[model samples]
Target: MRASHNQHLIHEVLQWNGVIARRAHLDLSQTIGRMLRAGELVALLPGVYTWARWAGDPTVRLLAVAAWSPDAVVCRLAAARLTFWPEVDHGELDLAVSDRRCSAKGFRLHRRRLPPEHIVGWPLLGEDAATDGRGIVPITGPALTAVDLCAELGGEPIDRVLRSRQARLADLRGALECTAHRSGNRDRRRVLVESRAEPWSAAERKGHRLLFEAGIGGWFANFEVAVGGKTYYLDIAFPHLKLAVEIDGRFHEDDPDQFQSDRERQNAVQLAGWFVLRFTWYDLVDRPKVVIAQIRAALARCRKLAGIR
Candidate 1:
C-alpha cells in the first residue's frame, strides 16, 4: 500500500473503533506487516491495527480495546466518561459482552448481554430517543451504567445521570430490576432508592439522606431560583419558607472562582428574602446531629418570621 493508502486504512479503522477489520483491506494486506515493523501502524490485536498517530489517544485506545473484544459495549466508568461526566476514571475501560468466551487485556468485562433498550451509541441519547445501534460503538445507556456503578460509586452516578436528563427515574428502576438477580445487588437497590430525590452530586446525595433520616421533608433538591436577571440552582431549597441549604463540596474549597461566584449567588438570594445555610462534607459526616439541629432551628426561625402555623 502507498503511504497515503496506509494512512487512509488507519484512519478508517480508528474511526469505527476497529469496526472495519483488517481483512476488509486484503488488497493492502501484503504491506501491513512491513508498516507494523516500520512503526507506521500499531496493532491493537492480532488482526487490528491503526495509524501510529492515534496510538496514544485515550479514546482511540478505548475503541481499540472494543474492537479487539468482539461484541464489546462500553459500560461503567467508560460509559460515564463517554456521556454525562468526562472527569471520571479516564483510563479505566469496562465493556459488556454477551459472548461467553470473550476477554481483553487491561479491561474489565461484564459477561452479560444488555437488552437493546439498555444500550445506545456514544454521546448518549435523550430520555426517549430510540436506537438500533447502527454505525456506532455501543455503550450502555446512562441508566444502566449508573445502576451498574452504584455498587462502586453509591448514589453519585444515579444522581448525575438523572441530572443530565439522559435517563429517567423509571429507567433507573428498570435497570435495577434487570440486575436484581445478581449477587451484591443490595447496594445497587439502596443507591437507586436513595436517588429518588434526584440529588445532583454525591455530597448532595449524602445531605439529602441526612434530611431523609431526620424526617425532614418539603425541601427540594436542585431547586431553581430566579433573582434579578440571573438564575441559580439551589443545592437544596425550601420554597415555602424561602430557605436554601447549600452543600459545599470539594470545589467550594479548592476553586476560588466558584467560591467567589457562590458568594454573589448567595447575596442575590439573600437580597430576595431567602435565608441560606451552608454545610460542608465534614458538617454532614462528622456532625450529623449538629447539621440537623441547625436545619431544624433555621426552619423554626423561618416559620416564626413567615408566621406559619
Candidate 2:
C-alpha cells in the first residue's frame, strides 16, 4: 500500500479528529472495507483493526488498543506483563483512563490520574509520542509496573514476587525510589522493600532452613559432592553418612528428561549405598513434620548401617 493510504488507515483505526479533505486520492473507508471483507484485517476493538493472523507481540496489540483510545493507560498485571515481570496470570486487558470515561465492554478500566513521575518515557507510534506497549498505556515504566504489582498483591504473595524472573533487585529498587520520590503509599513502599530483600524463589530457601532448624545435622546448603569422579550438587547432603536430599519444585516434574536424569543420579548414589530422600512442594507446604521425620529416619538408618551413634 502507498504511504498516504497506510497513514489514512492508521488514522481511521485511531478515529483521528481531523477531517479528510475531499481531494484526498485514496478512499480510506473503501480500503478498510475491502481489507475486512477479504479477511486481511480484523477489528480487535471498535476503530482498531489488525491484520488477520497477526500474532505479533502482545505489547504491540496493547499499544494499538491504547491508540484506539487516547485516554487509556495500561495498568495492573497488564503493565507487568509488558515488562516481563512474573506475577498473577491475568488473561484480560487492563487499562486506566480518566475518571469521567465509562469502562469499555471488554476492557477493565481503572479510573485514576497518573502523575508525571509515575509515567515513564516510551516510544509511541509517533516520534516523541508518550506511550508504550509495556503497561496500561505505553506511559507506564518498569518502576511503575513493579509498584503497581506490589500494591495489587498487598505484598503477601512473596513467592510469586520472587518468581518474577524478569524483576531484578535494581528494578525494584528503582521502582521504590520512584515511589518515594512521588510520595506514593507508604505501605506499598514498605512492601516493595520487603519484597526486594529476598529472592523470589524463597520457598526453596525457607524449606532448606526449616530442615536445619529441625536439627538435621551434616546438611549443607548448595552442597556439591563428587561421586565416581563426577560432581553433583545436592540441596542438602550428609556426605559422611552417604545421605542425599533433593528438594523438588513444581517445574521439576514438568521436565521428563530432567526427571529421568534425577532418577538415574539417585540410583547411582543408592548403588554406592547412600540413602536418597526427595521432598516436593507438597511436603514443604502441607507436611513439614512428615518431611523432617523422613529425613531423621534416613539419617538414623545411615547411622545404624555405619555403626555410628
Candidate 3:
C-alpha cells in the first residue's frame, strides 16, 4: 500500500512539473529514493528526476537542465528564442554561468558574468509556469541576446527584429556601447555599426543592391502605405509604378501571427492599387537573375499600364 502511494506521489509530481529535484522529493518519505533505484524514475541530471516517459521530451530535458543549474542564466540560441529573435530550432540547451562550474547532458555551457540589468528573470515558460511548479529561469534581455547573436552568428536576426519594430536599433546600440569594455566585444560592435547602416533583412539588402546595380530608379526602401485605416510598410516600392517588392524569410511561415499579418498587409496593398512582387531568401540570393528579371518585367508592365512609356 505504501509502495502504491509512493508511485502515485512520483507520478503526480512528474505530471505537474515534468521533473522533480531531490530537494522536492524529501517530503515524500524515502520512497522516491527507492523508486530511483528501481528504475521507475530516471535521473536526468545529478538530482533531477523525471518519469521515464518524459525523459525523451526536449522541453522536459531543458527544464531538467534548468533545475540542475539554479544559478545559471539561459543564453545563446535559447536566449535568442526567448527574446523572439529569429533562429533555427536549437538542439541543445545553452546557459551562461558566472561561477560554480555547471554542466549537464544536452546543454552547452557559456561562462560570463552578466550585469543584473541585462538579466531578465521569468518563469520557465510563461506567467502561469509557477502553477506547474516550474521556477523562474533567468534569460538575457533582447538587446544583449541580439548583440551576442550578432557577434557570433551574423546580424540577419537583428535586422529582422528591427524590421518587425519589436525592438529599437538605438536601444541595441546602447546595449552594445555599454558592453564595449567586455572581452570580444569588437566583433559585436562592428556588427552593430553595420546594422545601423542597413537595418533590414538579408534578402532585402541583396535585393536592394541588385536593383541599384541594375540601374533601377525611383524606388524607396521600406515605403509606407496607408490602407483600410491602417499604416503598412512595403519592403521596397516604386512609387510612380505603384509596385512593391517583399523579401520573405522562414520566420513568416513559422510564426502564425506574422504569417496572418503578412497576408492581410498584402491584401491591403493590392486593394490600394499596388502591384506586389514577392521573393524568398533563396529567390534573392540563389536566383538574383530571376528576381531582377521579374522586377524589371513588373516595372515595364506597370509603365505600360500607366502610359508612362
Candidate 4:
C-alpha cells in the first residue's frame, strides 16, 4: 500500500507541473529509481524528471531547470517568452546562476551577477499555474531580458517589451549600460537611441524616422486613445492637433476581416473629433515625399482650424 501511495504522489507531480524535482522529494529516491529503470520517466536535468512524452516540452524543460536551481533566474529566450515575446519557440532553457555555472543535459546556466532590480518572482506557467498552488519562479526582469536578447534579436524585442508596458525606456537604458561590454553593443546603442520614439512596428519605425528627419516633433507613437467603449491605440497621435497617422502594414493588408475592422475603427475614431491619415508600406517606401507633403498639409489645416499658431 505504501509503495502504491508513492506512485500516486509521483504521478500527481508529473500531471500538475510536468516534472518532479528530486530535491523536492528526497524520500522518493527508491521509487524514482524504479520509475527511471522502467522507462516511466526521463531525466530533464541532473535531478529533474518528467514523463517521456513531456520531456521535449519547452516549459517542462524550464520547470526542470528551475527545479535544479530554484534561485537561478530564467534568462535568454525562455525569459523572452515569459516576459514579452511569446512567439519565441524551440529554445533550450537558459538560466542565470549566481552560484556554480554548470551545463546540464536539458538546460544551461549563465554565470553572471544581476542586481536586485533585475530579478523578480513571476508565476511560471504550468497546467494549474493560476490555481491555488501557484509556484512562483525567480526570473530576470523585463528590461534585463530585453537587453540580454538584443545581442541576437536586436531592437525588436526592446520595442516588444515597451509595447507590453512591462519595462520603460529608462529601464532599457539602464540595462543597455549594464551590458555595454558585450558584443555588437555599438549597434545596440544605436537602436537604443532610436528607441526614444518607441515605434512598435517596422513600418512605424520608418514613419518615425521620416518625421524626425523633417524636424517634426510633438508626436506620440502607439499612443493610447479611448474612443467610445473600445480603447484604440493610434499608430501615431498628435494630441495637440488631434491628428492620427495609421500605418497600414502587411498584417493590415492580407486579412480581409482585419481590413474591414480597420475601416470600422477609423470611422469610430473620426467620430471622436480626430483627423486620421492612413498610409501603407508602399506609400511610405515608394513616394515618401508625397506622404510627407500630405502630412504637412494636414497639419497646417488642423492647426488653422484649431486656431493654434
Candidate 5:
C-alpha cells in the first residue's frame, strides 16, 4: 500500500483513540512499522505508538506512560495532582519503578522498591478498552504522595494537603516508616514534628506546639460546637470554660471570602456564649511567647468569669 494510503488507515485507527499498541497481525504490523519509520507515528514506548498530534498532550502522555509500564506507579506531584489536591504543579510526571528505566522525555523517574501498600491501583477512565486493556494504572496513595513531595518541597505542601483533608497523618507516618530512607529521614521527621503530630493546618499545628511547650493543657484541637443549627469546629477550644481560639493563616488574608467567613464563624461562636480569641500566623510562629501569654490571660479571665479556679 502507498504511504499516504497507510497513513490514512493509521489515522482511521487512531481516531477511535489517540493512542494504540502494536498488534500481532502481519499486514497491520507492516503498515504501523512503515508509518513509524516515516515519522508519521510517534512511539511512546516499546510497543506503544500515537499520532504526532496527540504526543505532546499531557493526559495522552500519561496514558501512554501508564500503558507502557503496568508495574510502574505514578508518584510525587503527579499523584498529588490526580487526587483531592489537583493544584500541585510539576513540569515532569513522576513515576516509581524498580530499577527499570524509560527514555521518555517528560518524566522524572524514581527507581525505588516501593512496598505494595504505597502503590494503589487506579483506572484511567474515558479511554478505549481495546487500546487501554482494563485501563488500570498504579499510582502512589495520598500518604505516600505526601511523603514523596515532603522530601523535596518540604512540609508546607504536606501540611496544606493534610489541612484540606486530602491525606491523614497516620497514613503519612505509615508511608514514612515503609519508604523513607537515610538521606531524607530528617526532613520526613521534621514534617511530622512541625505538624505537632496533628492532622490540622500548619499554623494550628504550630499553635498546638506552642501551647504544649508553655505547659498549657485541657484544650482540644478541632473541637466541635453547634451554632445556628450547624456544627462548627474550633481550631482549639476549652469546652468546659467556653473558650475558643482561632489560628488564622495566610490563606485567610489572601482570600477575602475566607477572611469574611472567619468573622462570621467568630460571631457564631460568641453567640453560643463562648469567648473567642483570634491569632494570626505570625502570632503563633514569630511571637509564640506573646501568643502563649495572651492565651493564659484569656483562660484565666474565662475561668474567673465561669467561677473556676
Candidate 6:
C-alpha cells in the first residue's frame, strides 16, 4: 500500500484494530512507518502505535507502548495514572515487559514475567487485547497496575502519586479487592492500606492538629486576621493568646515574591501583638514532638503574660 493509503489504513486500525487488521493484508511495518511519518501515530514502544494525541490520553500512549511489547505491563506512575491515583503526573511513562528482545523508544521499561492474573482487558483501547510490537495484545488491568505500582514504589513516590489526584482510596480498594482471592503479597497490600489510610496532605494537617491534640486548642486554621483592611490567613492560630503559626513549605523559599509577602504578613501580625511560630515541612516531619512542645510552652507563656492562666 502507498504510504498515504497505508496511513489511512493505520488510522482505521487505530480506531478499530481488529476490523482493519483482518481486512488489510498490509505488513505492520509499512503501516506503522506511514502513521509515524504522517504524525498520525506515536510510537509508544518498538511496535506499538496509537493516534497521536488521542485526546491527550496518557492511557493511549501507555497502551501504545504496551502494544509495541505485548508482554509489557503498565506500572509505577503510569499505572497510577490508569487507576486514577491522585497526585500522579501524566508526563512520566513506565512499563513492564517479559520479552528481553523487545525494547521501545521514549519509555521506561521493567522486565518481568507477569502471570495471567496480572493481565486484563482494555475496552477503551479499541481492542480487548494490548498491542505487542507486532500485533494488538492484552495487559495488566487498572487494578493490578495500581497494586503493582504501590508495591514497587513503596512510600517515596507516594506524595507525588497522591498529588496527581488520579488514584483514590476507592480505586485502590477496588484493585485490592479484585486480588483478594489471590494469595501472596499480603504484606504489600497491608502497606498500601496503611500508606493510603491518610490523605497525602496528612503532613500539612498533622502540623495543625498537633497543637490541638496537645491541649493547645483555640487555634484557628487558615485563620484570616487583617491589618489596614488587608487580610491574611494563618496556618494555625490562637487568637485569645495573640499567637499564630505559619507552615513554611519549600515553595516559600524558592519563590522570592512569596517570601517577601510572607515577611510582610509576619510584620503585620507582629504589630497586631500575635507571636508567630514558623515551622517548615522538615519540622513537621522530623520533630513533631518538639514542635508541639514548643507551641505548648509558647501558649503557656502567652497565657501567663495575658493573665488568662
Which candidate should be chosen as best, given lDDT against the real structure? 4
The positional error of residue 136 in candidate 6, measured at the CA in angstroms, is 14
Q: Largest TM-score belongs to which candidate?
A: 5
Cα misplacement distance, residue 122 of candidate 4 (Å): 2.6
Better candidate by lDDT, 4 or 6: 4
Q: lDDT by residue for model 5 over 30-137, one digit each (tens)? A: 788877887878887667788877788766767766657767788887788777468867678888778656656777677777889778766665546525565556
**Model 4 agreement with the true structure over 154-206: per-residue lDDT tens digits:** 67888789889999999988987776677677777788777889877667777
Model 3, which residues run further than 4 Å from truth? 1-4, 27-30, 85-87, 122-126, 131-135, 181-184, 207-223, 237-309
- After superposing candidate 5 on the true structure, give the runs of residues whose Cα lies further than 4 Å from its correct spot: 1-17, 23-27, 37-39, 126-133, 180-182, 196-199
For candidate 5, what is the TM-score?
0.86
- List the candidates' TM-scores in order: 0.84, 0.50, 0.69, 0.84, 0.86, 0.46
Backbone clash total for model 6 is 23
RMSD of 2: 8.4
lDDT of each: 0.78, 0.61, 0.77, 0.81, 0.77, 0.61
| Model 6, position 82: C-alpha lDDT score | 48
**For residues 1-309, could you state the per-residue lDDT of candidate 3 as single tens digits?**
977887797788777777888876777647778887788788877788888777878667767766777667877677777666545576677778876474667767777677677787756656688666575677778777777777767777677667667568787887777666776688878777556434477767667778867888788877889898899989888988999998887456888887788888999999889999999877877888999999999999999999998
lDDT for model 3, please: 0.77
Lowest lDDT block of 10, candidate 5: 125-134
Model 6: weakest 10-residue lDDT segment is: 17-26
Q: How many backbone clashes does candidate 5 have?
A: 0
Q: After superposition, how far is residue 23 of candidate 4 from its true place, in Å?
A: 3.9
Considering only N, C-alpha and C atoms within 3 Å, which residue pairs clash in candidate 3? none
What is the TM-score of candidate 6?
A: 0.46
> Which model, 2 or 3, shows the larger lDDT?
3
Give me the displacement of residue 228 in model 1, in angstroms: 1.5
